[model samples]
Target: MTQPNILELAKQGDAKAIALLLNRQLQPKGITATAALKDGCLQVILEAVEVPSQQVLAAYMSKSIAGLGAASIEKVKVYGRQTGTKVPAWNQEFEMAGQKLPVADVSETRSAISTEVTESKPLSLKERAKLGDVEAIASLLNIPLRNKGISATASLQDGCLQVMLEGDPVPEEELAVRVVRRELTSLKAGAIASVKVYGQQVGEDFPAWNREFEIVAQTQTVKQNNNVKLNNHNHTLGDSIESDGLQEIAKNGDLNAIAILIQKSLAAYEVHVDAEIQYGVMLWLKLKSDKTLDSQACLNRVSRILNNIQPDKIVSARISQINSKNPKQQAWNKYLAFKEGQFIDNTKAVNQMTGAFCAAVVIVLIFISVMYKPTSTTSSSPASSSSTPASSSTSNSTTPRTFLGKSQTGYELWADKNCVYVKGMTEGDLARLNTDVWRFKDEVKLQTGYKCVLFE
Candidate 1:
């Protein structure tokens, strides 16, 4: 039957057909095959009368089974063994007179197994280093380094492994010692034999490995033995201690040593008795009085205080103003209000001055009206004479005297200053002239007794 028909039969779980087909294919090379269906997958086991190398046997089995075209076979396990041996032929073994022996005879055998088993089992420091395990080396170096918030990674290079460490910009000596101790415990010490260790901050592509030891070791002795002293006092801040302690004290509003330092620094100026910390670091110095003090001087005083207490902890400091309720600030506000009132008073004064000037102009116009006088006019009187005391006296006078008389067309008389000025007036021009003549005649009568004639 065709290969496709054999695969079809195997997929249907026909054990007999699958075994027959595999045997037919492998028997030519003195190999026997067995087929079993387990866990929904076809398992093939092969045996050889004359054992061959694993590579050769595996290749041969792979090719022969591929030729079978078994679609249902999910896993292929090719085991080669001599026709009578129970042990698999692929495993390393020693043979004496055709009898298999254990791998203990090879000296390097233990080391090779150590490399594989170390990943699963816990071993001593020396055993782990001998096996050249990357994880074990990293763990050993990181024990003390963790205190400095540093971590390391190991990779094998040439005969020695390289450990690349990363952490704070400032390196601590204790971290380096931990790394060196691990290296010494793992392997012998020599320029070529010792593991190479270097530190860098995160994001630094290249680290100065040659100078790293010198840089980290420079202050090692000093920093290790002592803590950072504040001012001339006995209080000290250790390298391992964080800035959180200082922040806590500041949050509680207790100036403590910080206040003492500031008070001494700014002895020339009046300093505030109380100080406050905002947002953890901003030191607010409350002033006792609102005097024009130098801002830079205050800043210098704050800087001196910080340098003594916790230099790196406080980012910035400044002098705070006195409260608004202070007497000095209230007086300053009153002065400003007085200036504003002066401006308003000046505006009102200007308005009153303008009104006075307008009143003077009106009074001057009235005075001119009261003082005005008009000149008299001369004209021939009518032939009809009326016998009256005032007219008889002015009969021979050539000057035309004003007379009170009715108009020929209209009943109207013109008079001025309580005296008759014109007679028989019919038009507006004659009437206006009559009124002026009357005023002049009245003035003449008052001065020389020349009276105006009144005609009925």
Candidate 2:
């Protein structure tokens, strides 16, 4: 008997029939596919002795849904766990049948499925949000935020998911980030600049791990917005500090150096620093400017320098000159985060700082990094590890931000210069096709939080 097309059933939100059809191949391997519709996502649960990895199952299912050619069915949530566990330990959201697969590794997903047999379980609110399910995202955030008496709305804009908190006694930017990062981890994000995610694992337990694989995909060079103006005043470039040296230290996650660099970099504008504080990825710089400047405009400059130095680092740089009457003296400044060569107007930055006169001192003392340069020399640029700053990074500033491409579909890869390249090189042979020399190799250890942001 000819079974109904899974795509059509999925589009109609018929979770049961879809599960029945999916179970045909899945069930034989001791993995049952039970699906349900939640917030427009088809939530598929796989229960077994042990759940398969989230990335692999999502990729496997992504290939399936994408091949079916259904536009109506846009989201899929696959959860895997022990056969009888109430909570699914494995869960990942797969944005499916679209121009791109949201899975971490496009090349791997495009390849054959893993031979390992595994099952899935129910999707949690956090998992549902990964597929751009607004309700799930909102529901997951609404409770805690409400308890804190903050009114907020969460949404997906331009492939980015963010939460907007309104009303009085707004939570500290650091606290807010903690909530977001801890609450909906599957929906983690940094700023975007034609960025794609790669090198992500299938899940906690799926076994198609190519412990020995490296992919470097590149595509056409593209131009981006360079709106921020740069004017070097007082012309003491080399005298201050080796911007290069400070940058090297910042790459090693020196929070102190990051603040000093920001202060010194803005000194040319007569923007004197007051207090600077960072809560997770959110950074607030309270300043006293003798010259009038728009908040966003100042942020644009800060964003540029930070991006130039850090590349893909996520720091919501809130440039606030206004001393809020609010007692806590929070950094209720306009939030502009640096990502992919620009300052993005991201979520509001919140923090507290006590400052008003450190710019002159900052500039004079900046060059002292020459004194603090670590004694041990490891030439590689630090991979954005917040914990161990000076470890495991192979590339430097020129390194093309390695993305295990969540947005990419194994169709194209490119440098920020938009230099395009194809993948056909052997396991170890690499050649520079573009004159803009970027570190290229066959291996990178991917992490969860900092450098490797796994998202679509």
Candidate 3:
């Protein structure tokens, strides 16, 4: 009898069959594979006596399952761990269905796994660096980057590599970061999930600005440090700190210090009274009184800067803002929420609403101006209409008007209003009566008795 195809059986949600096929390829050098299908998503686990390389395992799985033509599997979530470890060190998810092929996820996954294959021996230097060996990685970077007059230091906190650069001309920030990322990636550093960079003058006491290069779909929650010295100041914001001065404190990842600097910025805006700063799983700022547009604007700008620079620290930001001193004034509670895989701030809704209201008013004014303009012709008194031009030559000199202006809107208008007598007219010309009237009022000072005769 012929044997059934492993790929076909695996597609039918046969976890054991998928595990067997994976194990056959993995070939057990103290390594093993297991799979479970959950909610139309196949999860594959890799365990080894020695920790396994997540990149190697994930790449192998993508090539294997993608070639299998498994339409039922919508996504594949891989978990890698040591044989005795309960929690997985490496975790990532990639799509699988309806694709010609699956490429390895280029985004690094968090783990402390070895390079090459899993063996009973000790891990290599590159593997150690992948597991957050700061000294090892820094030493490797020091040599290459030293000749460029850039000193490099790496710190791992909450799985983010904070690369502090002290150099001249502050090598282009993003380029600096990408080069660092590329270098570390080439060396297979798996622990550095994302990089937060701080650039400083070589001889300066502090960094002037800092930025954290964001990660694709990384967790937004920033882990808090219990070691920060919390302040217990009264309601009024203390000495307002300059935003530029806070850059270094923020770069140092000091939550309490950052909050203090934020308070200082608020103070400078004169909204210090009744301001409350709450920190923990989330950063919340409450402005109970004396909030002006300038105050709120400055606060929002500084807070957003902090959140963008250290998303891991300020994972979520919320504010209850009130511009008036009255305690009864309703406060606007705004939040930063995720939408379509990016953050959409609800606070800006107020600004957008104000802008839209102004736009609506302008539109209404334009509509009224158009609608109120007379669309039909007006008849003059019979006495004036019947007046015959006894001396048509005398009338020509009396009404010898100059061409003051002309207009075209689906019809032509030539105004000869030197004597406030608009001579050019047709049935359609009546539609432009309002425009001509306004121009005549300003330019020719047209009065109630001015006559406009039809020329056609």
Q: How do all models score by TM-score?
A: 0.21, 0.25, 0.24
List per-prediction Cα lDDT, in the order shown: 0.42, 0.45, 0.51
Instruction: Give the distance in Å from residue 438's predicted Cα in candidate 2 to where it truly belongs.
Output: 46
Q: What is the lDDT of candidate 3?
A: 0.51
The deviation in Å at residue 240 for candidate 3 is 43
- Arrange candidates by TM-score, descending: 2, 3, 1
Expressed as tens digits, the lDDT of each residue in 1-456 for candidate 2 is 122232344445555545654554554454556666766677877754456566666667766655544455678788887543468887887776445643322112323343643335355434455556766566555544544554445666565554565434434443444344334432343221121111112232322211111111211121223432445455333334342234433433345546666666665455555445566665666766444455555665565445434421345666666433432232225567543323566633221111111222233344563565444346544544233322222233343433323212232222233323323322112112210111121111111122221111
**Cα lDDT of model 3 by residue, 1-456, tens digit:** 122343445656555556655654453344566677888788988766456788777776776666556667788898988654568988888887666674322112212122455565565434556678886566545533554567778888887888888889675454455446435644555566777778788888788567665443322222222322223344222122221333323433445445555554444344432323356435565554553333345434454444333422334556655545555343455555423222346556544554455445446656875786544224655554454543231221334333334333332222334233333333233323422223333323332233442121
Instruction: Give the per-residue lDDT digits (tens) of candidate 1, residues 1-456.
Output: 112233354435544455555544444334555556665455555554456457544544444444344445544555666543457666321112222223231111233222322222344433454467666556545543554576777786555667777776735433353344323432432322445666677678775452212101111111111221113323323221112122212222345435544554444455443466667755555555455554444544454334323322234454544443552221110000012101011223433444454345445545764576332345634542445454333454444434344443343444444445333322233233332223333433454333653322
lDDT of model 3, residue 55: 72
Clashes of each: 0, 32, 3
With candidate 2 superimposed using the best TM-score fit, by how many Å does residue 86's alpha carbon deviate from the native? 39
**Per-residue lDDT for 328 in model 2?**
28
The model with the greater lDDT, 1 or 2, is 2
